[model samples]
Structure formats: C-alpha cells, structure tokens
Target: MKGLILAAGRGSRLLPISATRPKHTLPVGGVPIIMRAVQALREAGIDDIGIVTSASSEAALRDVTLGSGHLTFIRQAEALGTGDATLCARTFLEGQPTLLYLGDNLFGDSLRPVMDALDGADAVIGVKRVPNPQAYGVAVVEGGLLRRLVEKPRTPESDLAACGVFAFQPRVLDDVADLPPSTRGEIEFPEALTAILARGGRVRALEFTGFWSDAGTPRDLLDTNAYFLAELRPRVQGQVVNSQVTGTVVVEPGAVVENCTLTGPVWIGPHARVSGSAVGPFVSIGAHSHVSGASIRDSLVDAFTRVQSPERALSRAVVGRHALIGPPGEEGLQLVVGDRSVVRL
Candidate 1:
C-alpha cells in the first residue's frame, strides 16, 4: 500500500524554528519527525510514500528522504488546509489504497492493524481518548463504526479525538475535489470525511491504546520526546559515562561524552559531542551537534547546533540547525534560536 504524509503546514506556533525549517524536519529523539512517520509506514508494509509539502520545504523533504527509493514528493503551491494538501497528490494516488499520516504525529504502535482493517472498510482513522475532546476533531463511535465526526466541537459528544492516521481508498479523492475553502482559507480534511460518511461510505474508527503524540507546539514537542524515550530507550544503543540517565535515553553510535550529567528521557544523536554539560529529563540533541560548558534541560536542539560555553537553557525551547552560541555571563536562562542563527547569550 502507498502512504501519504501531510507536511505542508507552516507551523506558526513554533515561530522562529518553523520560519527556517518545516515542522516535519524538527528533531525528535535525535531523528527528524517525518523520518519516524516514514519508518512507521515502512514497518506496516507500505513502502511507497508520497509527501505533500509546500514549495519552501520541498528541498528539506528531498534531503531528508534521500536514498529512500520508495518515496515521492509533491509540492502544494498554496498553504491550503489538510484537504487541499491531500488533493495535491490526487494524481499520484491514482486510485490506490493509501495510508495517510500527519507529519507531526509520533506513533508508538505498529500501523499494521489499521492497514488490516481497510480490507472491509472504505476508510479507517486512528482515534485516541483525550482528556479534553473539545480541542480536537472528535469521532462518535457506535459499536465498531464511526457515527459522526465533529471538528473541534465546543462541546464534544465523545472523547475519541482523531489521531491523524488515516487509511482511505482512492474514491475519497472525489469527496475532496470540489471542497470549498474553510474559514481559514484552507481545504479542511474533516469536511472530506464528513462527505464520505454522508455518502454511506464505511468509515471505521480504530481506538489506539498505545502511545501517540502530536508535536504541534513547543510544549508538545518536548512532551513527545519524553514519552517516546520512556517507551523505546532500552532498544537504542549508546554509551553512558559519568551521567545519571533515568527513564528512556538513546545515545546513538559515535557520540562522545565527558564530565557531564545526563538525566533520563533524553536522546543524543549520532556523532554528537557533549562535554562538561548537564542535560536531560526531556531533552534531544541532534546529529553532530555539540554542547559544551552548558546546562540544558527540557529542550530540543537540532542538528549541527553548538551550545557554547556557560550557556543555560531551560524549559520548552527549540534550537535549530547550524546555530552558534557564545559564552553566557550569568544573565539569561531561556534561549530559542533558529537555523543558521548566531547569538551571544
């Protein structure tokens, strides 16, 4: 089966970081967010992947998917809603059954169950019970079928929020073709789902008990790193020396560390170097990044970034690629830097 990954959003909530790179390219657990999505699809026996992206992010997507032959990239000229982004790939889908994933969501369970469920269903969407359903697109399920879907209803009838993983037969494209723009001037996917349901299409909701996180904002990104680390740390390999690592911590191969304290639920990417730094308890250091003479807690540092001497960063901050930080003279505590930015904190 083919897969479609929607990664076209500008991620305004993420601000400076999203200004330079797409949200899908943000690092989680030392890997790009979209890479996790791709691996999940591949594990589900769906190697053929199509990514919907805006023109600004086309190059980044290509760079990330390099050497993955089963991947295809489609450009969505306008930043339309989810429906319009999916419609951009209608020609590529070509009447084939496909899996759809939101680029920002990190999944813990294998997607095979949803793939298997598509045998008898026209569409299958992954759902999870959220504490507050009013903030999400919720599904009302009766028996095993989805009775109704409300897009961010003020008073949700159910707590089963759509987890953004979907399986749809090609015919669903017809429902999206004539969709008018939503209030935000983008084609909304929930409307397409509603249309399909109205046409007597079999839309099934699969409740997932396993871990899933939507990293839409800075806080969500940090929380996702913590969640995945807690669940998948033992399986990852890395050397721990002179550090206190609790929960799930993944240190990739070829990473160097010395005179540093590392708390659990952290990930240090391949070839990363950390020296005289204190990190952890919800932190992710990207590939080839360097942190020296710094103390960072609860932050995501992107690839090739350098946190220079005497800097201290704390709580829900994202540092982008190729960033440089000079010495900090005990002045500030929080720093959020974008890609290719240089700052003397």
Candidate 2:
C-alpha cells in the first residue's frame, strides 16, 4: 500500500500567509499540515508515500519531506482539480492500493481503521457527521456502502460528510481519465468516482468521530491550530523569567518569556520571545516572533511577526509571517476590531 498526499492547491482563500508559501506548508501546532498528513500515513504503517505538488511548491515540498527516506514527490503541471493532482501520481502508484489524503486536512484520529477496512473494497472514504454538511462533500450511504457522493449539496441527504480522505484501487485512474469537467471546468474527482460507482464497485465508508479540519480559510486555520495544539503533550524548554506558565504549553529551546502569563494548550516556537504579555489558551507563536505588551489568546502569530498591542486584546487573530501588527505610536488610540475581519494595523 502507498500513501499519496494532494498538496498542489494554490490556497487562494488563505492569502497573505500562504502567498509566499504553499498551502500545505501552513503550520498548525508548529508542524506543517502536509507534514502532519505524512506522519498520519506513516503511523498507519504505509511508509511508501508520494506527494503531489505544483511547480511553485515542488522544491519546498521536497525540502520539507527530505528527512523522510521513503517519501517521493510527484509534480502536478497545472492547477487542475483534485483528480488531476492524483492522476499525476499514477506512475508512482503502479496498480497498488493508495490512500489519497488531502493536504489541508488534519484528522485527529488515525487512518489505520480505514486502511483495515480496505481489505476487499474498491474505495473507502473517511466520513464525519458534521452539523453543517453544506460546506463539505456529502456522502450518501446505505447499508454500510456509499450510495452517492454530492459536492456540497444544498439540502444534505445524510450527515456523512466526506473528510477528503480516500483509499482507491488501481482502476481509479481509468475513471479519473474518463471524467468530465465539473462546473468549475476541472476534472472533479467525485465525478470520476461516479463512474466507478455506476460499475458496481464496492466503495465502503469509515466513520471518524474525532476532530477534523480542512483549513480552507483563515478562521478555519485558526480553529484547526487550536484543536491540534490541545492534543499535543505539554513541554517547556525555554527560559522563563517572572512568568506564570500553565497547562499543556510547549516552549521550544531559545525562547525567552519575561514577566508574562502563558496558559496552554499553546506552542511557542524556537527563538521566540514573549515579554510583558499574556499569551495562552490555544495560541501558537511561530519561530522568532516577538510578543511584547500584548494580550493574545486563541490566535496564531506567524513567524517573525511583531505584535505589541497592549491596550487592545487580540483574540481569534492570524498575524502573517513578518507582519508588524500593533497599535499606532503616540498612544491614546481606540480600535474596534470585528470578528473574523482581517486588519493590517
């Protein structure tokens, strides 16, 4: 069995942050989403893995997966649909069963259950019962088999939402080649699977009840960061001075915290400095970042970011890498930030 990760998407929704790097490179809990996806596959005992990347991300993807001796990179020529991206790995797949994991998605549970259920199945898609099914690819299941797959159906027929994790047989490539373009003019992977379903292929379903995030937008990314951060084991290796740190927080080496209050499920990357601030409760401060005179919670401050907003509390925010977001000079400034709104100040 082989593991294939689709990481070629441009990630337009996650702009500014993803503008310089590939979507798959976005970090959650200080680990790249693509890397975590690869780790998940490895944990499931599928060591032979191939990553589908675009030209823009090919080099970085290789660099990120370098230490993994068994990982291979497959370049996708165009920004086609998921089907096209997976199709690029056809040669590498070589008729072996493959697990197609979406790059942006982070699943809390292991894929071993799905792999175990693929003993004689044509395909098995990981599904979760979500409150809002309209935003996901809804799967219609009957008698433990996939009846049909709908792409964001207006009125969802079932609560089973496709979590972008799929196991496909060798014949899946033929179906992908024969698929018609979706409304967006790209060969949709689901449409390709429709052909396989019509031919009586035995596609099964595996239900996942734990946390899952498809970090498409900024808010989604922030939420995912918090979710995964909470699951991490707490550790502190940095220099703490007159600071109060509590509960499941990871402070890597070279980090310095002075006169600050930090509450965990949080991650402070290496070389980061937090002074005269309160950071905590599901927050991630990237490498080399400086947080001074600020109160941040449930937020993600990217690498090299400098945030010094002591007056106004920062919550549910995403500060892009190298960004300088803070209150204006001369003080006495009042700002009202809206929820889910992006601000450059």
Candidate 3:
C-alpha cells in the first residue's frame, strides 16, 4: 500500500505560530511534525509516499521533508477539505491501496495493526477516545465495526474521534471524488467513509490507546512535545559545563548546555546553546537557537530564535524562528510569537 499525507491545511487553529511557517514544519522533539507522519508510514512498510500540500507551504514542507523517502509532492490548488486533498493525489495512488494520514496529527500508536486490519476490510480508520467529540470527526462502532462516520456532530453518538489516519482501498478514491460538500461547505473525509459504509463496504475502527494530538494549537504543541520527550533516551552529544541535567534529556551534537538545570525529558537540538537557564520537564530547543538567562518549562523554541529573558519565567510558549524575545515583567511571559517577530515585555 502507498502512503498519502495531507499537509495542505492552513492550520488556522494554530494561529500566529503558524503565521509564517507551515504547521506541519513545526518541530516536536526537534523533528518536524510532518516528518513524524512520514516515519510512521515508512515503519509500516510503505515507501512510496505522496504528500498533498498547498502552493504556499509546498516549499517549506519540501525543505523539511527532502530525501525522506520516495515522496511525491502534489499541490492542491485551493484550500479544500481532507477528502478533496486526497482526491488531488489520485494519480499518485494509481488505483493502489493508500494509507491517508493527516500531517498535523501525532499519535504514538503504530500503524502496523491498522494496516493488518485492512486485509479483510475495505477500509480501516484509526480512532481515539476524546473528551470533545463534537470538535472532531467521530466514528460510531457497532459490534466492533464502524457503522457510521460523522463530522462534528452536535450530539455525538460515540466518543471515538477519527484520529487522522485511514487505510483505504483503491475504490475509496472514487467514493471520495463523488462526495459533495458537507453542511460546512467542505468535502470532509468522514463523509467519504460514510459513503463507503452505505455501499456495503466494510470499514473497521481501530482504536488507539496511546498519546494522540492534532497539534493544531500552542498548547497541543507543548503537550505533544512533552509526550515525545518523555520517550527520549538520555544522550549527551554536546558539551555540558557546570550544568545539572537530571532525567531523560537529549543534547544533540554542537549543542552546549552550560550552567543550566535541565529537569529531564528535554531535547536540545544541534547547535543550540542554553546557558544560565532552568529549562525542562518538557522542553525542546530548536537547532541554532540561543536561550540565555531564562527559566522556561513546557515550551518550544523554534530554530534561529534568540531568547534573552533574564530573571523571567516562560512557560507554555511557542516561539517561532529568527525571532527575538526579551525579558518579561513581573507576571512573566507566555507567548506565541511568530517568525522574525520581536516581543520585549
């Protein structure tokens, strides 16, 4: 089966953090979000991958995902919905079974089982139990099979939110192409799956119990970063001078952590410098970024960003690349600054 990733979404929920860069290019644990989806598909033995991207984000997405695999980039002309995005890549699929994964969603579960389930079924949807099913496309399972797929239902019949991964047969593409726009005026993937069920096609619902996040907001980015960081093995490839690093932390080559207290489950990217700071317990400093005299926790600092906030505590912040963040006032700063932006509080 081939793999198709939908990375063309504008990431409106991510807001200013996604203002300059594609949300899929944003890093979680020093790796781009789209790269993680690529890895997941690769691990499932799908080498021929196709990434559907918008014209504006194609360059950025290509830069981060270059040489990742046998990847083909298909540009979606308009900001269509997920089903429309998949239909745009029909030529790449070439009538073969395709595994469609949303680029922004991150799940810790393996796709091997989902692929295996597709052996007997026409489609298999990866689902996770979420609190707010109204905000997501949900699956209704009856007798261990997916009975219906609903998008943002007012009264959700099931808590199983469709978690952005689906194994579809070759004929599913025709069904997607035939689907009309939903009430929201977009051709949603859920409607496509429901159409498959209506045609007597079997669709299995595979529930994922592991960590899963859409990563479409600053808070979700921090939470997803922390989840991935928690699985990080302790490795120090950089220089640590007068620093106390506890727990699991990965200091990549060329990164220097000096006079800092890293409280575990942290990732310091290559060439990043952290000095005189208290970082960690879920933090990822991007490559070539510099953070000095700052007390940061549960934050993601993008590459090439300069944060010089002495005696200030920054938490739950997502700082973009090439930006400058100054020291904050008494209340401290929890910001979502975009690329090349300056925040001097």
Candidate 4:
C-alpha cells in the first residue's frame, strides 16, 4: 500500500498565521504538522508516499518534509477539493491500494488498523462521532457497513463524521477521477465515496474515538499542540541556566532558558531563548523565537517570533512567525497575530 497526503488546502480559516506558511508546515510539539502525518503513515509500514500540495505551499512543504521518505510531490493547480487534490496524484497511486490522509487533519490514534481493514474492501472510511456533524462529511453506517457518505448534509443522519482518512482500493482512483463538482462547486472526496456506495462498492466504517482535529483554526492549533505535548518526554539538550524547569519539558539544542520557570508539557524549540519568563502548562515556543520578561501559558509562538516585556500574562495566544509582540500590555492578552506582524499592546 502507498500513502497520499492532500496538503493543498488554502487554510483561509487560519489566516495571518497561515499567511507566511501553510498550516501543515506549522509546528505542533516541535515537529511540522505534515511531518507528523508522514510519521503516522510510516508507522503503518508505508514508505512510498505522494504529497499533493498547492503552488504556494509546495516549496515550503518540501523544505520541512525533506528526507522523510520516498516522497513524490505533486502540484494541484487549484485549491479545489480533496477529491481534486487526490486526482492530481493519480500518477503516483499507480494502481496500488492507497491510504489517503487529509493534510490538515491531526489524528492521534494508530492508523495500522485502518490499513489492516482494507482487506477485501473497496474503501474504508474513518468515522468519529462529533457534535457538529453538519459541518463535516457525514457517514451513515448500518450494521458496521457504510451505507452512504454525505458532504455536510443539511440534516445529518448520524453523528458519525468522516474523519478525513481513508483506505482505498486501486480502482478507487478511477472512481475519484470520474467525480464531478458538488453543490459547493468543488470536487469533494465524500461525493466520490457516496458514488462508490451507490454502485455497491464494498465500504466499511471504522470508528475512531480518539483525539482528532482538523487543525483549521487558531483554537484547533492550540488544542492540537497541547494534545500532542501531553505525550512529551523531558529531554533538555540546551542550556538551562538558573531556571526552574519542571514537568515534561523539552529544551532543544542551542536553546537557552535562563532565570525562567518552565512548567510541564512545554516545548522550547531549537535555538529559542527564554529569560525571565514563566512558560508552561502547554506552551510551544518555536525555533529561534525569543521570549523575555513575559508570562506565557497555553500558547504557541511560531518560529523567529519575539515576545518582549508583556506586563500581563499571555494565554491562548497563537503568534505567527517573525511576529513582534509587546512592549507591555495593561491586562492579560489573547492574541492571534499573523506572520511578520508587529503588535504593540
């Protein structure tokens, strides 16, 4: 089996943060989100992978995913839909059963079961019960068999939403290629699955009740960061001078944490500098960022960002790369600053 990751979404919902880089290139627990997906695919024993990316994100995605595997990058001319994105990689699929993972969906569960489930099945759709089923592709299952797939139905039949991961047989590519634009005017993957079901294709529903996030918005990013950080193992490869570091903290090499109080589940990326700060409890400071005289918690400061002298604490903040936040703030700040932005509070 092969792996196909569709990373071509424009990520407009994550704007400003995604202004400079694709959200897939953004870090979660000091690793790029796309790379995490790659790891999951690799763990399933699939080495040959095809990544479909947009024109704007292709270069950046290549930079982060370099040397990861036998990766073939395909460019989707437009940000159509997941089905269109998959169609862009038809050459890579090459008549092999494929594992299709949405680039932005972050699933913390094992994917080997999904791989194992492809036996004698035309497709396996991963489904999880979500409160907002109408917002996602809804899966209607009866007797553990997928009866139909609907793309954001007006009235959802079930709470089981398609979780953006699927195992497809070799002929599924032909099915996806023959798909037409949905009412949303884009080629949707769910519509193709629904078509497959209409033709009596063997489709099974796999229920996943673990942590899964599309990571499409700021809140999703922070939540995904914290969820992954909870599994962190303490490894201090950098200088921790005169600091009170506790819990599951990882200070990467070339980083310096001086005179700071770092609580658990905090990640200080390589070459990041933190001084006179109280960082922790689910915070990820990106590579080469500098945080000084600030108290930050439950936030993500992207690579090359600077947080200086914020009198009040920062919580639930998602600052993008090369951002300059501060001088000081009168009260606690909750920000969603974009890349290369300068915010003086």
Using lDDT as the measure, which candidate wins? Answer: 4
Better of 2 and 3 by lDDT: 3
Residue 340 C-alpha lDDT in model 3: 48
| Cα-based lDDT for every prediction | 0.82, 0.86, 0.88, 0.89
RMSD to native for every prediction? Answer: 3.4, 2.7, 2.9, 2.9
- Model 4 lDDT, residue 177, Cα: 82
lDDT string for model 4 (1-345, tens) is 999999988787888777767889988888899999999999889999899998999999999988876789999998788888888888888888999999888887898889888898899999999999999889889988899887789999999999989999988878888888877778887677777888988898999989999889888989999999998899999999998978999999999999999998999999999999999899999999999999999999889999998667899888888878775346656676445544545
For model 1, give the 10-residue run with minimal summed lDDT: 336-345
Model 1, span 116-209: residue lDDT tens: 8888888888999999899899999998788899889998999999998988888888888877888788788767778888888888889998
> Candidate 2 on 1-345: residue-level lDDT in tens?
999999988888887667778978878988888889999999999999999889999887877667767788899899889998888889999999888898889898999988888888888888999999998899999877888999898999998899989888888889899888787888777676668789988888899999988999988998999988988997789888998888988989999989989899889999999999988898999999999999999998888988876558889888777877677667655555433446654
Please report how far candidate 4 places residue 188 from its true position, in Å: 1.1
Candidate 4: which stretches are off by over 4 Å? 328-345
Using all chains and alpha carbons, the TM-scores for the candidates as numbered come to: 0.88, 0.94, 0.93, 0.94
Superposition TM-score, candidate 2 onto the true structure = 0.94
Off by over 4 Å in 2: 331-341
Collision pairs in model 1: 81-186, 81-187, 246-264
Q: Per-residue alpha-carbon lDDT of model 3 for 1-345, expressed as tens digits?
A: 899999998887777777877999999988999999999999888899999999999999999988775689999998878888988998889999888899998888888888888988889999999999999887899876999887789999999999989998898888898999877688887677788888999999999999999998777888899889888889999999999988999999999999999998899999999998999889899999999989998888889989896556888878888977775556866576445444545
